[model samples]
Target chain A: DAGITQSPRYKITETGRQVTLMCHQTWSHSYMFWYRQDLGHGLRLIYYSAAADITDKGEVPDGYVVSRSKTENFPLTLESATRSQTSVYFCASRGTGRGTPTQYFGPGTRLLVL
Target chain B: AQTVTQSQPEMSVQEAETVTLSCTYDTSESDYYLFWYKQPPSRQMILVIRQEAYKQQNATENRFSVNFQKAAKSFSLKISDSQLGDAAMYFCAGAQGGSEKLVFGKGTKLTVNP
Candidate 1:
């Protein structure tokens, strides 16, 4: 079903440069989220959107921006990438069914900031 | 704010044995959700199982199951008949009612030995 997909599965960028990771889902889920996985730090939420135009800052939202212009696409942008920003980024989505909170995750984007 | 914790940094289980990965969380919300995700070397985050706070019965998917204790704020995953495919980093995550943002644990690296 290609439940969830991410673009540029791998990327390399220099410090102070801008980078964007793209996520798309086929389920048309009502919620979309961005997370970065790092050693010892686990996976930290970066940003999330409740719907097409409703976005909110997550625990690690600083230095990052997100926009959900469409229900299936949620893109995460790093204004100025830093060495600390080098991590595996994941995107996930969930349907709006009541009492159901299972999230479907994408393959993830591996970003390397030099 | 909620916090998830996985105290075990690594765990090992025999190919035909059972293993339990521990996870605990702190949250004031009475209605929240917990999830267990598996990430292999391929970096694909796969949902092994999930539990809803209101459900007393633990969730199970094939050989995977979860022990959900709402009062204790504990959600542990148990894998029976472990196979080589079971080797991966297992993550525990949580989210408040109706919230799309998730808090993740540091993860437990599982090794399935033959």
Candidate 2:
């Protein structure tokens, strides 16, 4: 009752469209993640990658696809963006090297579909 | 299963004052790591501090420090000499020992008033 709780933040999307949110990190962290921030649900992971060319699904991976061709870039594509898919998408990266456990995030993409 | 909690929806402080954002987490892994990230109006997530579960000492970065209570599963960030630039959204995250996938909080928006 005293810490962080998911409140109602919102997103938007068209019925059937494709939207790609791109995340790029300059630090070249070996791990990258994609998350969607919403009210009540909080920040839900869509996908993550440990390195270039390797990826895995997170808690909520449906309607979303991720790819990592380079260490610095991780992109999230909503194959068919429904109105429900409209939300704030974040890209994050973290290094595997010593003294690096925090995942730094990209400027979130605010997607609005009408 | 993994979970991170930030109960505060928003917090306000004056410039030059100190503010602490509370976070808590749950994980099966004993050797986990905790993190605090700041996202300004720019929406870019910046690393604030990181606390490794293996270490007894807390983590510090400049004016930022963490109050890591391992037994309590608490990782709170304390920002001393808060500046106007300190106004932003702060998020708490947790990662397991070797898996490295992160579980995040909904976030708390910090407002630094002059």
TM-score of each: 0.95, 0.85
Indicate the TM-score of model 2.
Answer: 0.85
lDDT of 2 by residue, A17-97 (tens): 876676777775788988887766667888999999999999899999989999877878888887777778877777885
Ten contiguous residues minimizing lDDT sum, candidate 1 chain B: B95-104
Winner by TM-score: 1
Best candidate, DockQ-wise? Answer: 1
Tens-place lDDT digits, model 1, residues A4-83:
99999999999999998999999989999998988999988889888999999888889999999999999999999999
Cα deviation at A104, candidate 1, in Å, is: 1.0
True contacts kept of each: 0.78, 0.61
DockQ for all candidate structures vs. native: 0.75, 0.41
Point to the candidate with the largest lDDT. Answer: 1
User: lDDT by residue for model 2 over B1-114, one digit each (tens)?
Assistant: 888999998999999999999998988778888888787877667777778899999888999999998889888999999999999999898888777677889899899999
TM-score of chain A of 2: 0.84
Root-mean-square deviation of every model: 1.4, 6.3
Per-model C-alpha lDDT, please?
Answer: 0.91, 0.81
C-alpha-based local distance difference test score of model 2: 0.81
